[model samples]
Target: MTTILLVDSHDDARRTLATALGKLRSDWTIAQADSGLAAMSQMDDKSATGHVDVIITESQLVDMEGVTLLDQVRSSAQQPLRFTLSSNSEAEAVLANSRANQRFLLKPVSAEQLANIIERSMRLQHALNEERLNLYMSTVNAVPSVPAIYDEMMKELASAHSSLIKVASITESDTGLTVTVLKIVNSAFYGLSNRVESVGQAVTLLGVHLIKNITLTTKVFARFKGSKLSARRLTQLNDEAMRIGALANQFARLAKLSRSTTDHCQIAGMMANVGELIATSKAESDDGQPSLSIEIIGARLLDSWLMPYAVVEAVALQHESPPRNVDMLSPLVVLHSIRYLQKTFTDTTDDQQRTLCHEYLAQLVPPAVAEDWMDAFHAIEQLTAAKPPRAA
Candidate 1:
């Protein structure tokens, strides 16, 4: 039975979480502490028989702030997993150290989501203690410049019909990219039994859309290999964002909303965080990054790059309610909310959100088509996971 400490001034939250967790796992123990001091004292319980596996703390506590208490926990405890529970929709820009493997969970989190976080965090802890994985983060954080191959690929993707042959032709022209892509696809990442020997096979395995992103992002990761911050957090954020973006695009396509713009659905999802991801990488090299901090920097990047204003607005206001603009194209808010549901799974406001989804889905699509939209996202996820890597 894993023991978890819940410290927060909010009685409702404490009780609510405790009840839900207990319902989820009968043997699990949830010890309540109103303040950080009480939490530290409880941690010091000499007679405390069960191990406190993780601490679910709040950022704003009466005795001490969340991060301050976490600093102390790091100093005294045996690196117990610490999670900061808050209503702040924004994620913590800085992930917990690889050793603690802890994370932040917004309030109204579901039992399933909470359980998943706990399991992953503990596994990370075990791996750290056993020294099975290494810790590395970029020290001098410079967001690597986009690779030329990727830029050209995107330009072409945005141009005339770009078939597999066109992609191969583009790669064939660049000797450096041709070799590099072939090397990556063959690397352990893809797990191809027969190593990819050419750029064509790599592209074929990755598919055009995915290869486009890989060509764009791989160099970004490779450049920061020896840096202070590990690329894990950025990659995780991007991958998750991509999945949601793809889903959003799929939803839009089903609604028959933005077909004229080409894979406008996909474009909406892909560029939703273009500004944020790029800017986050750049800003971290300076001060410690914070969520909701770099939205403008990202927005500016997109604006400068001549992206559609609708896409920019949609990506910019990801954490807030949908903007009530007159244009129907401003579906960013709605699309973002759908993606947000993954993290915002608490039942407290689920009814409202669900109604909103239903109403919004009805507006863009018939009931049957909207149902198909949801089904498609799940199928895409499964296919993406199972599909063999794209060949060059």
Candidate 2:
């Protein structure tokens, strides 16, 4: 049976969540601890009995913060999925400490919301194991806790006094980052009719939130130049990432998803292939393919960089379909659709390809979005085609 551990300082909140979860997932066993130390003890007690499936905790514990407790749990051989509860004020701190695939829930979460998110987290854990992804993730070097410029940008955005112009100025100060961001905006993935020559222009077209994400992913790619992969191959991977990201953004915009959601869709799209940098470096020499998946590797690295949970989940599940649910507008779905489009268009069959493309769009998106989907796709195609290719 599935097992879950709930950790919270408040007795009432802990019991409430445990009771609700028990009702929602009657077959699963539910356990609770009043503090981080006790939670670790509970994990130790359950280690031999298949460990815990999920750990749900409040941000503040008597002895330590939720993320610190989960970090300790993660360092152990057992890898239970982690979720932390936080008020809006503690969001930045939680994001900093949250593991690559761990999730965060806001305060006052409803019973139905908690139940559903936990169920999804459990389902995600199964998907990770079944795919044998994350099996070799430990072998990969951890990405930096967070890149400098990206961290600064996040802080600026969080401040009420910060403005887009200020963030753009910060991005402009980094020449390499500025060039990379402009390249992406000018590339086919962004699909703009007019060329964007500067960081300010690009930020004008795409929001600052997205530009910051782009900067982070680009910096990671730049760091990989010293890796085992050849310069040419790294370039190809970067190109692929850009294409996927652009397509995912188009899909989100066409579907009228929220601006925040759209930004995550692009971030997930851009970073989905990150694990390949490690996988190819270490595992390519082996005869058979490694059981580990690049998606998990990428997700973990992104998490280490303190990317939001939405971006991490989208990247992790990009290659796997979550169980069908009422929420069709999820970033994961957007990433999946983009991947499908890339695969279907792999061959250049003129007529047959067109028909297949139309069919895929119609079936993948809701009826309400079908018309806008075509418009969005064509606009992106034209925008990308107009730009001259750049060396990867």
Candidate 3:
């Protein structure tokens, strides 16, 4: 049975949340603790009704900060999904210290919001093969921590006085990140008349939203630098990511999708292969495959980082054929179609797979629509090919 532990110093608040959650999910056994230490004790109890599957805590505990509780829980063997409740004032500090498998919910969290979080978290956990993921994680020498600069960028962006200049300053703090941001902005994908030589310039040209996504993609790739994977292989992966990202962005724009969705599509496409990178980094040999599929691993990682649900879902489902009833132009559809088309056009020789891709698209959209998408993709490929490769 699913179990949840609610940690809060206030007796009334703790009981209120538990009662609401209990009503929402009658099957879930709700436990309560008034302090961080007590929460840990409840979790440690061998005789507890069942192992805790999730933990929700207030930002401030009588005994310790909620972040401290999060750190302890994450280090524990069970590592239940960690969430901390904080007001806007405390969000920055809370975010600064938290890592994967943890999330921060702003205070005044409604019962509905909490329920949604639980549902999504449970669904993600169930989708992943926990045993295999654990085994794979154990074998890796080091899993990248959530990038500190990324966290800082987020905090800065959330500030009332947030500015592109301040964001640029934060990016510059990490020299490697600065170089990467500049490199991507200046790439042919953006098609700027002049080169972008600084983070400030990139931010001014692309706007903060696009730059933020680019920063995240670059930082994630940077973490895997100097891994067991060869430089050539890594470079190839980076190039492919950029290509997919550019294609996804172009598709979104051509379809006139919302700016938010366009950003999601771009990032999801860029990050679709992150699982492959992670698996390759820890491979025992050059071609060794992890027991878990790249999609699951990448999804798990992205979910932990608190990525948009759509982006995470797109990555998880990138390798799967689209559901018959799914929207033809949704972010997931765009990403899946782009990835499949790119693969088929390049090196995917499986006739069965190619047939399935074509059939899926044909089922969802008219023949002409599918053809237009294909034409657009090929146009993007040709444009990309025409540009000289830029230095990393």
Best by TM-score: 2
Q: Model 2 over residues 125-170: C-alpha lDDT tens digits?
A: 5654553555465544534446788778877875657688999999
lDDT tens per residue, model 3, 125-213: 67864877877766666467667877787777655577789988888888877887788777777779998888888888887767777
How displaced is residue 234 in candidate 3, in Å?
A: 0.5
Off by over 4 Å in 1: 1-146, 154-164, 172-214, 217-225, 257-262, 271-284, 290-292, 323-334, 345-369, 377-392
Global local distance difference test of model 3: 0.74
The candidate scoring highest on lDDT is 3
TM-score of 2: 0.70
What is candidate 1's TM-score against the reference?
0.44
lDDT of each: 0.56, 0.71, 0.74
Model 1 has an lDDT value of 0.56
> Residue 365 in candidate 2 has what lDDT?
66
How accurate locally is residue 60 in candidate 2, as Cα lDDT from 0 to 100?
A: 76
Q: How accurate locally is residue 378 in candidate 2, as Cα lDDT from 0 to 100?
A: 55
For model 2, state the Cα shift of residue 229 in Å. 1.5
Q: Which candidate order results from sorting by TM-score in descending order?
A: 2, 3, 1
Mark the regions of model 2 whose C-alpha exceeds 4 Å error after superposition: 1-21, 28-116, 125-135, 141-145, 188-197, 284-289, 326-328, 345-364, 378-392
lDDT of 1 by residue, 165-262 (tens): 68777877867656656754564433468977766676677556545544544454445445544466655554554555556655665666523222
